[model samples]
Target chain A: MGFKRKRNDKEGDDDAGEEVREVSHTVKKSHVLPSSIKNKDQRSAVYAKIKQEKKRDKIKKTRARDAAEKKALELGEELPPKKVPRTIENTRELDETVCKPDDEELFAGHDADEFSSIIKRDSIPKILITTCRFNSTRGPAFISELLSVIPNAHYFKRGTYDLKKIVEYANNKDFTSIVVVHTNRREPDALVIIALPEGPTAHFKLSKLVLRKDIKGHGNPTGHTPELILNNFTTRLGNRVGRMIHSLFPQNPNFKGRRVVTFHNQRDFIFFRHHRYIFEQKETKQSDTKGKKVKEAKDEKSTFKGKTIARLQECGPRFTLKLRSLQHGTFDTKGGEYEWVHKAEMDTSRRRFFL
Target chain B: MPRSSTVECGGCPPFRALSFDVLGLIKVIEARGGQQGNTPKIVERWGEPDASRCIVAVSINDRQNNPLVAVGRKNGEIELLSATNGDRRAAVIAEGGAIASMHLFKKEQSELSSRSCTLLTCTINGKAMLRSIEITNSSSDSNSTDDPSTTWNVCSAGTILCSSVDGNEKYALFGGKGVELNMWDLEKRDKNWSAKSPPKNNLDIFTPTWFTSAAFLDKDDHRKVVVGTNSHQVRLYDISAQRRPVISVDFRESPIKAVIGDLDGNTIYFGTGSGDLASVDMRTGKILGCFVGKCSGSIRSIVRHPEFPVIASCGLDGYLRVWDLKSRDLLSAVFLKQQLTNVVLDTNFSGEEPTSAAANSSPNDANAVMENQDEEDTLGPVKRKKSSKDNKQSKKHRKSKKKLEEEDDD
Candidate 1:
């Protein structure tokens, strides 16, 4: 070992002495790009060579680790712990509004929230869907798609009516919620969700819409209620928004329909997606199979009941919604007080998120 | 509460016997605290960090019940506690979704029982109820709404965002977005007057009318009221003059969230939705300069110490800030961790715990206030307790949320 170390040091000294362009004192000398090679073409060639060398070195290290792991397995030893890569999500700033599982106050609040009656199946959800009075483009088409997506939703044309009067009309008619799809120019640009009777109106900026016809191989949705899935709604505001959205759908979903709807929130943007899940049987990899797995795969290849593999088929009309403001009451835009308003100044830090 | 063992600002009880002077501590950091920055030394904070529910409504104790504060949480639970030491005495369950406002006032039923404290709470659902409290000789008090009380639905065209009782406690005013300012005569149990919308501007566009905050201009005259609108306008209304506001003044662009009048009646302090807190001369309809220090979030509540020359403001910024009223300097600031919906000053906090802290009693040296060192105890206040959480060390206390109807005494 001493002889190998002595020879490697002598080789390093000889290389540093020959490489005269840049003078540096880092422990490792191989990684530094030669500053003296000022020629653009030469520097590019040297950079490509270094990149290839680094790629090869990484592959070699992974191969060595795999070999060691195989040897350990053969000797019936413990495997190395998995290394977790650091990402922005994993290193998110601490948010005080995040909900805890056993928070009694939060649970109590949930019991009394506006959506509680509908979500608990005490009363059926009655949603009234409408477009702004002067909606253009695919507004009607979007409303039709939404009518099918949401259970027990009725289409109500705005028809040059004041929003307050509409809200009053809906209140008299016993509508649980009202969804106003606002279109600007030629596209749906905003959405207003107002919980009825007692309200907290949520305004959202709609963008990146993709109609079902736009998506290739999109499956047609069935009349059966779609199972709703909400993800990453952990903050207080997010929880309230989730509840408002949840109340729009029927509580009793027919699982036999295999239809699914998802609202996934990431970095304050909520992505809406619709899909149908199908259970598929796994195709056996006989070459890699060692025992019972091969036999089970072969036996139940045609059957779907015992299959664990699930596949999602996209059923479209997907869009992204970003919360613009949450008003304390119904759609009185001119005078309503906003519970939380998104302002240009609020986006001071990229890591700081309200929802 | 004794000095639990004072070790140079180590541990001070929430209320009285603060081991260290708060101003001295802030003076230590004043060099770094920055001028006009959040520099006030916080003497007391009510709740813990990360509590499930934040304080939505707070009413200062009446002078007779000095230092005993009535706090309403978002989940509709009101707890009566000691302002200085954080000792909870009783609790009440209010309903109709998040408490929108709470007012502590003196309800004089008859000439016999001169002054009885009444607590009125209004929820977002427009349910308003007034509960009168009684002090029993035996140390056990129970009240119920059945005997005789006031409970009514506001039935506002829009959601009721805020309601305020005059300093004289004779009337209550309510206003919100789409809801005009309506005054109710407490004695008559009827509407006294309602505001009229102003005529359309030169462009013939009717200006939006929404009252975010309103306050009585004088302690003796309930007719004169100062209102802050969501349109960023501050209007002074004199009921004796006309249904419309007498003096109209427009402040900064953001909607006004809180409005409070200084003792002078004409001088008003209003905090805007954009976290700008400034004073306005009501009589002249002139804009006074802004108070020093900036709040990161919208301002929700503002309180003036009746005895002290200080003002404390808190809001969505989650900070409790105390400012020198005269100098407009940020005397002290403390981040309470949870976004504060309302703040109330305990005027008689300078007195010991037994005397009770009075509201509206301003003192010069409010810096003597301190915090509760148990730190962990604040978590309990966040959760609604159905049973009266009688301080085990103290004698028997009032039952949770009992309304004492004057019938018992009559």
Candidate 2:
């Protein structure tokens, strides 16, 4: 009995100790979050991923809504119900092929020669990108892509009428020539590319190009009228480019003593003598005379007689581009009966493209 | 009746001999010799590397009945220190900015395990963070696990709450520009809900850069909020109305540092930055009385005792003054080298064995009692015979009671 009593006591003592330990252990484990949610880092990552996905979906919906509205407005349909703008809408559709490598074939073997050497000899080609601002991410993407395709060529993004940042990039001595893809009317936004040369010598040279007379309206005049301003800027830009090349190669070091010549077309194109390009004008296919050569052997005197009837009708001012001392013979597109303007009119013609 | 009972100060007999001085800073001077024992010097020092520039406001945490000081620093750092030992036990850093105001909720022993005790800290850059650190100790584990501190940014509406309290899941933050009071919750960490207060647009016409103070006035059947503005005005907000303030009162000539004094939920003491102290009836919005106190500088903090009718005030002048309501006289003044942004007395031991040597009224007072008690207790055997005579008187009374019972039966 004594032995049994002692054994019972020992058993009780062991049970008591185990109970205390178990109670404390249970309490310690109970306060913590469940095992499934223990890893906060993983949970937060998943939460952020979900949030990003939601934002993307919202943007897509907003874009679709905007596109539908734009289409409805074009069709003259009733507007959609009004609502606050929730997500940002993507307005511009990216056309990758519009500025891609179809021109690469023109410069296939030109990689062996330096860009300056080839460009001086009228061998290397240039690709022009029309842009209103350098801030757009798309503008950078377009330039980088075109540069990858066309080697030994300069990529010009139509700069705003301020030429500072653009002039810095183009005047780096590495570039062959920066072609501002601009129309010579309406103060072409592209002249900004030519206006802002950043170097100390560039400021002095550009001061001569500033319009001396202030126009009555928009007193801060780039030139005189919007059309004249564009034309004058283009002309001045051409002169500066010629001076830069002249200073670079004093006697046409690579071009066998050929001097840079400038020319303009009725389409408002300003190209140098050495810079040859494939001019592909996309025309409205309004007529079915698709395979005919439309060039007519009419001189300036004959053209004036042909437009005599229209002039008598007094429809509107017939704008024209005038050129002085043509250096090269001009070519026309093979098409039908379309009114054609001579490249000379690019400088002096008062006529403009109505559409 | 004995005028003062021989209250047990821990196992030792109660001795009244502590003296406190409040000049430029708080200095606790203890008597060298006492009947019980010599009391140790009590000093509580706070602040870190950037103590001078970083500290903006300080408040006493009298709820714990212990000397817990809440300090808000310029870098939005909050620290709760053990006032007895000057140990930085709990520290919190909010988003970087200058801390505008701070308050520490009293911890209840029954709910000690709960993460309900919160430090509401506000920054000048329009941010309010309610930080809670829950300390849990289990009987089974000798090793303790301190829960990681959680802080929630409470100001998303470009507004800061002057005073905020978290109870259970419901938390109320009151005061913003234009008298806009908001009561929100940690449970709804997404946003702050507008907790309605009276004359809702009181601040609409008047723009105040600072609100003096705020307190929860009525919580029984009706939840109410009280806010004091720099314009010497107090506004009471009823949560149920969801509209303008229930009542408003112009109670001070200067900004009031308001504090709730009683569990009865009626008494509130407002200490002004200009040395004006006012007590107001929360129910009626009437000024009960006002007094001028020792405030050589702007009063930065005011806190009432948790269990006693005692009020402690500290200011930029580097002095901490304690007031006894019964006498309306200065109880003690502690002189500190640095400005007293806050001052809190440790009353946790007020009910416990008073081991605090600083509690003696004067050094001589403490020495006299300690020596007397030591001598009396050591001669305990001699007193036993005297105590035995008192026991015999009790026996005599019992014998008489038996005789009286027998005579009544006859």
Candidate 3:
């Protein structure tokens, strides 16, 4: 009895456990491997054809693979598997770094070619303007001019004829910094700088001395020689301005260094600055080098002795923020203290800061 | 190393930002049960009044309501118990046909002591019976007027698989020979609305089974009936729209049970065949982010507290887990060593404090105390059993301590 067997892999398949016909199941003896090989040349030809087909298929697959890889490399992306679509959850996470300020990135908007003057806080940002008379309009004009230059600067409204009121406010009310403006004809024509211990308070006294006596009536030094007076005035103003520039910005807790320019007249200017404290360096020789030049210069432009820029050298006992360099003469006749930050410090952007 | 120096120069804070923990899982207790394939015999293992059986559905009634916990078992037996003392007050209230589902009504105290509540039980044998029990305290001296048990023939069809009772005593029936959702208004004692699922693919050959869990959502403005099907989907149908479900959510797992409650049934908590308990926002049709974990067994039943937005659920896995609906977080869990076919919580228990704000504040904060006091007041005098005098004293002390702590934070 001949029967056929059935595959029962899926549902609704009724045929199973059946016997197969002997004629269909029996192997054809003439088609066996040995018998097929008896016709050697024909069999060899068939084998060659199969081998050629295999090689062609392999080469095609390799070419396709190479082409796909080359395209992926050119596009800066790897080919994803030919499957499901991607979702937002598959993207890379975001960087969480916060940005901060950098010294080289200060005045980001300005040109960088010019040599920038770096400023540090020597003391609170303060300045005083003294003239010949209280109502000479020079003192008021100067006060207004300084206010116009830095809108945040404080003016005490003290008398040039009398320095007591200015001194009392500076000492008692805890002002950030003090400036004393006195006429050139008064005694003690000297610019003084007094440093306070802890609190933001400094005492200053500016006294002007008579240079030449009047030879005419009343014998009062009214019409003094302009040369001597101008020389003395410029000298004293230069020293006082230098000292004031060395003060700190009162409100800044992180004050490090500063660049200061003091203008007295059209011909003379005083430049004093404080640099960031380098705690480990031996600073004795540096401070002496700057001080000696200032003393020797007197009124004339002290010869640049190549003794390094007259920097306000730091003494380590304190967080000695001192002058880094000094260049005195007249500034570009800008007629005002041009306040601008250094280009290098201003160029840093938030993106570059993180990088 | 030098890069670190550059970072130091930039003056960045030496610490990381803050983070908060969302899920507060205090404890986890496992119950006894094994994963097994679906079979009629396996399903029958739960219907007995054995504590080892899974507690499928749970509910805690308000103090004034004094609701009872009616647990429907896999074997089609229901056990009514008192939630307050964990006492099995009624051993076998009803038995016989394979129980597809059951629910106990929210009742007033007068109704509670008098058993003036309706309990709806559905069977796989195409029978839906509404049993009204006039509960009488055996310890009480008062004479009971009404009969203790009364049975009403609600509906008869193929398996009367799922049934839901609304606040108005309306019964919504889901399973039968057809995919049609049928509602029987218990108030009117008649079938009001019905909807049928369209035939599709392989499912088209037979009418879709009735929803195992169904409820009326947003009962205030728009009355929407939400039904959970055996096919693992949650469908919402506006009663105003000829009973056709308006939204169907593929919840990914079969929602074996569902309930609507809390401020117009805006929140819906349901369980899955995979022992997963989840909630849905009916208004938005969005799944509230539920803290993920498995109950000891497949959640066979679920019920919401009558007053508070809390849910009590039980599973074939034998564990009973309580959930906070709004937060969708597991609040507490109790292990029932045996498969919990049905579970219920009595709402008579005190409410838990709203912890989000107070969670960060010191316990003694005066504002927290005042806020809690305000909540107590809102709960009404009948809810808080403590005398007013004691509450006032405790309030004062708490306020003072909180004030002191606030000063410290400042």
Best by TM-score: 1
**Model 2 lDDT tens row, B1-410:** 11221112222211111112121122332212223433223332233223233356555554443455566665555655545544455655556666766767664436454433556666654565656644222222222233454555555554453665643325656465443566656456554445443333555673333455677664442366667766667776676775566777775355555554444577666665445566777788787776444333446567565545556666544445565554454555444434345544454432212223323434336564475445655554335644664478678788888889999898
Which lDDT tens digits does candidate 3 get at residues B129-157?
66665444552332323335434454454
After superposition, which runs of candidate 3 have C-alpha atoms over 4 Å from their true positions?
Answer: A1-355, B1-67, B71-80, B86-96, B107-118, B134-136, B139-156, B171-179, B199-207, B219-222, B253-264, B294-296, B305-312, B323-327, B351-410
The global C-alpha lDDT for each of the candidates, from Candidate 1 onward, is: 0.69, 0.43, 0.42
lDDT of 2: 0.43
- Runs in model 1 lying further than 4 Å from the true structure: A1-37, A283-308, B1-58, B62-66, B70-133, B137-139, B143-200, B203-212, B216-225, B237-246, B251-257, B262-267, B271-300, B305-341, B348-410
Q: Which candidate tops lDDT?
A: 1
How accurately is candidate 2 docked according to DockQ?
A: 0.00
Model 1: DockQ score:
0.03
lDDT of 1 at A347: 55
DockQ of each: 0.03, 0.00, 0.00
When summed lDDT is taken over every stretch of 10 residues in candidate 3 chain B, the lowest stretch is B16-25
TM-scores for all predictions: 0.68, 0.38, 0.36
lDDT of 1 by residue, B1-410 (tens): 11111112211112221111111111011101111211223334334333334466767664545355676765556766555456555566675677778887644556424224568887766677877654222223434232245888765567777788987787988887777888888767678888998888899999877788889987778999988988889888888889988988887577888999888777889887757788888878887778756355568888776645666777665566666667677755554434456665544342222111212122223432122223324534222221222252132223322223344555
